[model samples]
Target chain A: NAGVTQTPKFHILKIGQSMTLQCTQDMNHNYMYWYRQDPGMGLKLIYYSVGAGITDKGEVPNGYNVSRSTTEDFPLRLELAAPSQTSVYFCASSDVDRGFPGYTFGSGTRLTVV
Target chain B: AQTVTQSQPEMSVQEAETVTLSCTYDTSESDYYLFWYKQPPSRQMILVIRQEAYKQQNATENRFSVNFQKAAKSFSLKISDSQLGDAAMYFCAYRSAFGPRDTGRRALTFGSGTRLQVQP
Candidate 1:
């Protein structure tokens, strides 16, 4: 079903470089999120979209931006990538009824900023 | 802010044995959700189990089950008949029931993962 798909499974960027991480979900869910995970740490929220045309900053929004122009696509932008930005990025989608069950996560994008 | 905690940084179990991972959370909201997500070397986040704060009965899936104690704010995952495929990093996460208006926009807070090593 391709529940959630993220592009550029792996990428290496130099300092100050800019790139976009693409995420799409075929489930037509209303919620989508971008998160970054560091080694031995939990996933940190980067940005999220409730639905098409509504985007909001998450816990860790610095140096990142996101847009939700369509129900299936939500892309994360990394601007001026820095060494601190090296981590694995994940995109997840979910429906509103998440009383306890609701999220489908992507495989993740591993980015290394050198 | 709601917070989740996983005290175990690492754990190991032999194949066919049972293992339990502990997680505790702090939240003021009475309605919330707790989850266990497994991430393998492939880095795909897989949902292991989930528990609703309002539900008194714990949730179970196959060999996976959760011990949910709402009064103590504790949730633990029990994996029975563990297999090599069960080896992975397990994370505990929290989400408020009063999430954003749109379901897709809610943010999840996660605890540091516990590395599970299943030996043959």
Candidate 2:
């Protein structure tokens, strides 16, 4: 079902440049999240949306923005890329069912700000 | 806020042997969820196992099982008959079970992960 798909598996951006990491899920999940994983570290939530048009900042939301225009898509935008933003970004989705809270994760996008 | 900790930064297990990865968490909420994820070279997060806080029986999936201690706030993943394919970075994550009242609190809080090396 292509549970969750992230675009541009790898990319390199110059300092001050901007780009968007795209994420889509066919599972019709109501909750979507964006996380970044630094070297030898676990994933840190950057932003999350409970549903379309509802977004909120997460643990590490600085230097980034997100928009959930549709239920199937949640895109993360880096307005001014910095070397500190170099990390593996992941998109995940899950339903609101009380029975299970597990997430379906994408393959991750590796970004390097030069 | 909740936090998960993986004390072991790395671990090694000989093929066909068993290995356990330790994870501890801090949370004030009684109802929550715990998970172990495996990330291989491909960098795809795969759910290895999951345990609900209220479930007394330890969650087991094939050769993978979890030792969940509610009182101790510990969740360890044990891999039996370890194989080369099992070598990867393992992460422990936590999520509070707050219902619709707490909409955005459902995000999983992850630990710093333990890299598992399956030695041949």
Candidate 3:
């Protein structure tokens, strides 16, 4: 099974551009999250959803947005992408009701903005 | 809010030897979970080991294990029989057991991370 799938493994954008990072999971998890990892740093939560139609801001949510329209998909949107937004983005999901083991993270999307 | 810290930025271990990466966290909640994740060059975040705050016994998976000191809020990962394949960046993460209804958010808080290099 494709646990968590993130599209556009690599991408480059210019300032003021916009893009969406896709994330899909087949595990039927209720909780999904978006995180950005800068070089030499750990991952920072950007946005998350406990279930469909319920999204919330995370630690770093200024330049990004997220929507969970269905159980299997949670996409991250970058609006007016700036150079400071350049970082590797990761998508993760977990089922909290099932005695949550750990998050299943996607391979991640490496993005660069100039 | 919980915060995790990994003091060691880099570490090395000889092949087949053992190495431990330290992680400390600050949290007011007593019921929480700790985890260690390995991210190789592929950037795949793989769960190494996990420990529930209530569980006094450490968690182990094959060659990976964790020393969870609940009172100290310290969780360290120990890799036994280290191999070249074990070379990767390791991260420590914390998650509160409090349901989203109580905390409004249940996402994990992660530490900076420690890069481990297995030497031959």
- The candidate that achieves the highest lDDT relative to the unseen native structure: 2
List residue ranges in candidate 2 displaced over 4 A. Answer: none
Model 2 has an lDDT value of: 0.95
Off by over 4 Å in 3: none
lDDT scores for all predictions?
A: 0.91, 0.95, 0.92
DockQ of 1: 0.69
**What DockQ do the predictions score, one after another?**
0.69, 0.87, 0.72
**Native contacts kept (model 1):** 0.89
RMSD of 3: 1.2
* lDDT per residue (tens digit) for residues B7-26 in model 2: 99999999999999999999
TM-score of 1: 0.95
Lowest-sum lDDT 10-residue window in model 1 chain A? A93-102
Q: Candidate 3 — which pairs collide?
A: none
DockQ, computed on Cα atoms, for candidate 3 = 0.72
- Of 1 and 2, the candidate ranking higher by DockQ: 2
Worst 10 residues of 3 chain B by lDDT: B98-107
Candidate 3 is graded, for docking, as medium
lDDT of 1 by residue, A22-86 (tens): 99999989888999999889999989888899888888899999999999999999999999999
**Each candidate's TM vs. the true structure?**
0.95, 0.98, 0.97
Please give, for residues B1-83, the per-residue lDDT of candidate 3 as tens digits. Answer: 78999999999999999999999999888888898999999999998888899889999999988889888889999999999
